[model samples]
Target: MLLPQVLPALVVGVAASLMFLGISFLSEEFQVVLWDDLPDALGIGRYSSLWMITMLTATGIAVGLVVWKAPGHSGPDPASEGLGGAPLAPGLVPSLLLASALGLAGGVSLGPENPIIAANIALAYWLGRKAQPSLPGAAWVALASAATIGALFGTPVAAALVLSEALSSQPGRGSLWDRIFAPLVAAGAGALTTQLLAEPSFDIGLPPLSDPGWGDLLAALVIAPAAAVFGLAACYLFPYVHTAFRRLRHPMLMLPLGGLVLGLLGALGGHLTLFKGLEETKELAASVGGWSSGELAKLAVVKLLALLVAASCGFRGGRIFPAVFIGAAFGLLAQALVPEVHPAVAVSSAVLGVLLATTRQGWISLFIGAALAASPSMLALLCVASLPAWLIVTGRPQLELDHEGKALH
Candidate 1:
């Protein structure tokens, strides 16, 4: 009986996943050409400090041009938008898609999540209204957002947890599960679609923690709050950085300027600090022992700053991906500082803290942290550690801004 009502959501979810994967494919192809083929043809090292600076700067200019001349100014300032902001006009989708693809391929410190979600929402809303005028717009928004979240994380559970939080806060008529039934079906279909097509995985292969001990608990208590402070610093600074860029008064000036700063940051932080930080975090984890405490700290600081700048200065992307990198770096730094602390515990706890501050979504943060650690024992530690971290960020300004340019709580 329920299947009849949910059939449309399932179809929409599959379509949304295909759209997300399609954009990702285009971004990867462009990334290879820009960083691999073009550099090879020019006989320049792709990771060379100078070349990274050049490419990032050029990417900024290109994205800026799109924003300045393209429709809808690339779908609003990224700093003012959250992951599931309102849908855009369908006509604005192409420019947003182009900007997002360029930012991803150009090594900006933002993720494909935000722009991709916005694009999907707009498309779904427009098409769904045309097909069924009686279905409320919110239904399309809910299904599209759920599908994208599931596809992004390669799991239906992520969408379920996130939507549970969202739906719990709203005044709805049905039981919570009843309300989310269609979205859950959508999320499941999206997750399966991406799983079959992309096979994305968040586990970075860190050694598992078979034993839980007092020392690990102490490490979580200390490291999680410390990492949360780092994330809070960015949250506090977000509005100011955004204001500074707004002073430039045009995308042509601010975005190119932002790109130049990002290029310099890339040079200082080295190649690891470049891009959205998913693959880079894996590389960091693979050679965790090779880095000194200072090097790990530097990577975290640099990536955090890059994320701040990219999101603030009109770049079309999300902050969550770079926040994950910062968390991993700080976690590794904690282990570097105290040899007794288990790496899995330290990493997950730190990830929990940073994500709590940056994303303000506890379930998603906990899920990402636990996924990376891949240790059953670390779950209790992360849940406990998240309490203090959550308290720190609960009443404070979020990383995003409201309409008047003030920070959102």
Candidate 2:
């Protein structure tokens, strides 16, 4: 009896792995072309303020066109979708990609990475339906989509963990086989995609812990509660904040708002907190050795608030990257508050926010903490910090979902 179920899962895993890998390759090329040539093509930096405004307006119009003409092509964002079991429609992939690209190119506060992952999932769903028609293509699409996301994020394992936790809202009641298959496909897809894209693995290089003593342990204990509180605050406040976005009543208006906000931020800081802040966050962590305590705190606050605002205000993106940046910066600041604790230890402790908010798995945060700093010792410290926060947040619902599994107002 179980064998039949297991066989189908295995098949889904294998097929999803292949599809995700292929799409990852395509996405990589797409990213490179878009990132390298588009800015120059648009003369992004050479124009006057009016020209810049006009360009942004044009981009907004484009996004508006896509969103208006195409339904379900936008909203709520990737982390929410992954958390809420939102179904994917493959036909929406082209429109979403176009809109996401326009947003990314126009310097919106959104990240294309998550949208790309989602697009691939949508693609897989469409293909599976066209081929098998009768099979549970939705599940396979999700599995394959997850695999692509993991691979693209450079930590397919972490991707797997987050998706599994999000899908299994009942904790231990869902089909364990589904959970297993999804991640397995995601890992394979992620690895293959990463390879073809020439993207480096998720290894944010931080100095190794020289001597993680009792001081470090103490710091982790302190930071754990604080991180959980911060996460809870964001989750609780999200609905109210996101309500501003819904009020726009039109993508045209919302698109311009996204561009204006992104433009003001980009013009002020030269992309400091724009985009996903993933690469920028990693760079900041590397520069921590040279930054003063004041500088670290400032960076932490800016990134955290920017990310919160972006997510809450109808920006299209994922919180995962910004969360990493926020956690890293917060960790650095925590070290300053407690001089004895290592910065690496502080970073590990800070990564628990996302875990507390949605992804309730301890290992995912631990791996992210470790991967973000590229230090096994730091990762170990994160494991210590995230466990308690995970326990605390899991018992409570972080997000409200409607019958369709969409986020509620």
Q: Per model, how many backbone clashes are there?
A: 0, 2
Candidate with best TM-score: 1
Off-target runs (Cα >4 Å) in candidate 1 are none
TM-scores for the candidates: 0.98, 0.77
Candidate 2 backbone collisions, by pair: 147-186, 151-190
10 residues in a row with least lDDT, candidate 1: 1-10
Per-residue alpha-carbon lDDT of candidate 2 for residues 1-409, written as tens digits (9 for 90 to 100) = 3333344444444444444355434544654454446556876643344434454455556666777777665644432554324446656666666666655555444555566666656665666567556557655555555565555555567666666656666554457665466456545555655665555655566667866777787788778667766666666665665566657877667666655654454444444555566667777777766767777766665555555555554445556666776677777777767666777777777876554553455556666667766666665566676667766676655533343334443
| Best candidate (score: lDDT) | 1
lDDT (Cα, tens digit) per residue for candidate 1, span 50-111? 89889999999999999999978788878889988798999889999999999999999999
Q: Can you list the residue pairs that collide in candidate 1?
A: none
Model 1 C-alpha RMSD vs. true structure (Å) is: 1.0
Taking all chains together, the TM-score of candidate 1 against the true structure is 0.98
